[model samples]
Target: MTSPGRTERLVLPGVLTAEQAAHTVAAIAAEQRPDGAIPWFRGHHLDPWDHVEAAMALDAAGEHTRAEAAYRWLAAHQNSDGSWYAAYADGAADEPTDRGRETNFVAYAAVGVWHHYLATGDDAFLDRMWPTVYAAVEFVLQLQQPGGQIGWKREDPEDGGIDRTEALLTGCSSIHQALRCALAIAEHREEPQPDWELAVGLLGHAIRSHPERFADKSRYSMDWYYPVLGGAVTGAAAKERIEERWDDFVVPGLGVRCVLPNPWVTGGESCELALALWVMGESDRAVEILQWIQHLRAENGLYWTGYVFEDRAVWPEELTTWTAGSLLLAAAALGGDEATTAVFGGERLPVGLEPDCCTQP
Candidate 1:
């Protein structure tokens, strides 16, 4: 029933077979255009967040050049305000089908840039990327609401600018993690971005204390686990949060659902949840979560995006770059890769100045 993609490569020791991890890395790199742009797939569109995710996976696999190329592609295409359009055609196209700019999507560049630097220890690469990360962070913070929650997207002026200032809990949690990575980069470079430090603190506060400031997107799985995965939610609070929705988003053998009350299980969300569980120190459960999603694996070592259990079919029919990237990242985290542990587990990244003591630190 699975479609073949490519032969498996080197899998890791425990978390994944060397071949599995290698195939995932190769799948993503194989999809990169000559310009270093990696689409969701060969012919799909490239969004900054997923593009960064795939690039990070490439870095994990020691494909530093390809990863840097991906970042360069992003740098060359970035809008003047440090943002990228929501989507672009697979190649080096400058035009976007959607002109709206997303804060989380734009802000995630910092995470990838920092991760790439950590993986490669390339100071020059970091220097090249700091400006892009700085501009993107500045662009993201420009839309931060007074409540400290960031707006999801700045609507196109023609589409009603002020009316589109709404924010999302999942997106803010993601941005919260990105801000921490940005601060880490700042600290590593000795640039001392006080504003980014303050933003990181405030963003953590918003994620912890001001849930009301964000839109109610509880139906989605990312909303359930992202706070923990993003390092915004931790300790007893993170455990409590996961326990509260464990039944809602998880299926026994299928993996995490993309949404509640849905029979669809997605590879990305499931792998993300595995990473969250690893962060919580539940290695047994996290391993089980990864094992449960093996059904999504294809003969070629790539994975299907999601499966519809009710219909017993693979939906969307695409082996997306980010889905595999998420899986590799989660595996690397579990397999004790230093850079990955530092990036996702928040072990090495510097947490900047503390904000209002409204919640756990």
Candidate 2:
């Protein structure tokens, strides 16, 4: 278990004290299996993206060994094609509940690996994970559309080969961040990936200037904030983008709504919005957002997935490590945790090259 003092950096006045942060960190650590997989809960399934997020929280709280174990779990379970299935049974090694491979889910390993590297400064670990990251990036770029948007997922053939010819605004934005991290790793190892530079540059262009290429998920708060959070949109444009939808998704003291027309606010979305806000240099607003989501925290130190504001009840009745993870990470950023801040703030990350011919202006 990580010491309570290790989580001192996660202390935020209205959100968490060091003791409270330690409790939350321990709750997540307790759910982690001996093999290092962190499911949504004890009996739930694990998804690649959320698994990485939880591991990142552990790192933020100075749980390096546990974090490294989580990465090892990912490496052990990776498909020969460089992707993991969409869902896996929590306690079983070979039991995948869902066989479809999501582009963003596969790409997210890079973000987590890069974050762990930044947190621990482990060169040998980076070298060991390099091939994994490289393979995953190649798998994701295989799904990129000609217009520079990545197809959200490749459905299982058993599901009748459903034609999923659409891209998601949120997923592509996430992949944008992952691609940058992959390039950073490449640079550190003195191995140049010219193709990745082109891929990331074009993906960023699509995200910033051509939203029409992706599916319309604007009702979801992730679409509203992810481009900015992922570092593809910046400066006055990022601020303007956030302001345009601030009223639509934000539920005042309750936090961010999962979607429009639904009176439900989610801890994960709220924390992610806080992260995007922090990326834009709006730490005050970000901290305020994090403060508002404290209502979702359960007695167990984990958080409920969402609150139905209209029903005035906790919906889903499930506590998620990812929700708590997102909160800790946002708080870590606000608290000046260097690793969390560097990974998300992204000023030091490489921006892949966008050619003159592809310039938006």
Runs in model 2 lying further than 4 Å from the true structure: 157-163
TM-score of each: 0.93, 0.98
User: What is each predicted model's overall lDDT from 0 to 1?
Assistant: 0.84, 0.92
Error of 2 at 24 (Å): 0.4
Expressed as tens digits, the lDDT of each residue in 176-219 for candidate 1 is 88998998998888888888777777778888888888889999
Q: Write one digit per residue (lDDT tens) for candidate 2, span 1-361.
A: 4567888889999999998999999999999999999999889999999999999999999999999999999999998878888999876664889989999999999999999999999999999999999999998998888888999887885787453659999999999999999999999999999999999998999898898999888889999999999999999999999999999999999999999899999999999999999999999999999999899998889999999999999998999999999999999999999989888999999999886768745
User: Clash number for every model?
Assistant: 8, 0
- Pick by lDDT: which candidate is best? 2
